[model samples]
Target: MEQYKRKIALTNARFYAYHGYYHEEQMLGNEFFLDIICFVSNPTLNTDDNLVKTINYEELYRIAKEEMAQPKKLLETVVDNILNSIKVNFHEVNEIEVSLRKSNPPFGGDAATAEVSLYWQSGT
Candidate 1:
């Protein structure tokens, strides 16, 4: 038995997509960032050198990229969607988290960015 395994993550992934509440935001688009983490439990993590034995990071990035392309009004919604997508694809993961950030929101002021995050763990 290999016990538990290490986590896999894609951090600071940047995308320019039309996603926001205001009309201009949907039209003009803006910079968006994402961070996804998946904690996997696999018995072969230490023994097998095969990609199939553990979480494929490229597949994880693909899920986030696809979800980010869809325009949504709220970051929370986007985060939720990403989480669900990951859950659907990587059903064996022990824990997962997704975070989305919108850079320099239109409100002006000195606010750096608007961010939202969603997290999940197996068994309540």
Candidate 2:
């Protein structure tokens, strides 16, 4: 007997939205990058080339976009929302990893970006 696994990923998704704690930050808006990876238990479903067997990238993008559109003071909150949405909607996903980056953050120095990463697994 053998076990099979599959991973689907969406990387470098860019969005400009109002997500910050400062008043100026919200008003000014900023660019954000999102990366997501979903793990599946059945690898054969991927080989079958069936849409129903795999997570839809478009749907995943839409979920992320919708969540990002909402203004949240913390990037961690945004990541949590996205992660929960994916897990609820796509039960086939056994594990998920999310990375979010805010570019050119207003640190008033030479900071390029600020990022946060989150991982979630079912039943844990």
lDDT by residue for model 2 over 1-124, one digit each (tens)?
A: 8777788889999999999989888999999999999998855545666798778989999999999999999999999999999999998899999999999889875759899999988783
So what's the TM-score on candidate 1?
0.91
Writing each residue's lDDT as its tens digit, candidate 1 over 1-124 gives: 4466679899999999888999999999999989999987654554757888778889988988898899999999889999998889987788998999899899994758998999999893
Ten-residue region with minimum lDDT total, candidate 1: 40-49
State the C-alpha lDDT per candidate.
0.88, 0.91
Q: What TM-score would each prediction reach against the true structure?
A: 0.91, 0.93
What is the lDDT for 100 in model 2? Answer: 97
- Clash pairs of candidate 2? none
lDDT of model number 1: 0.88
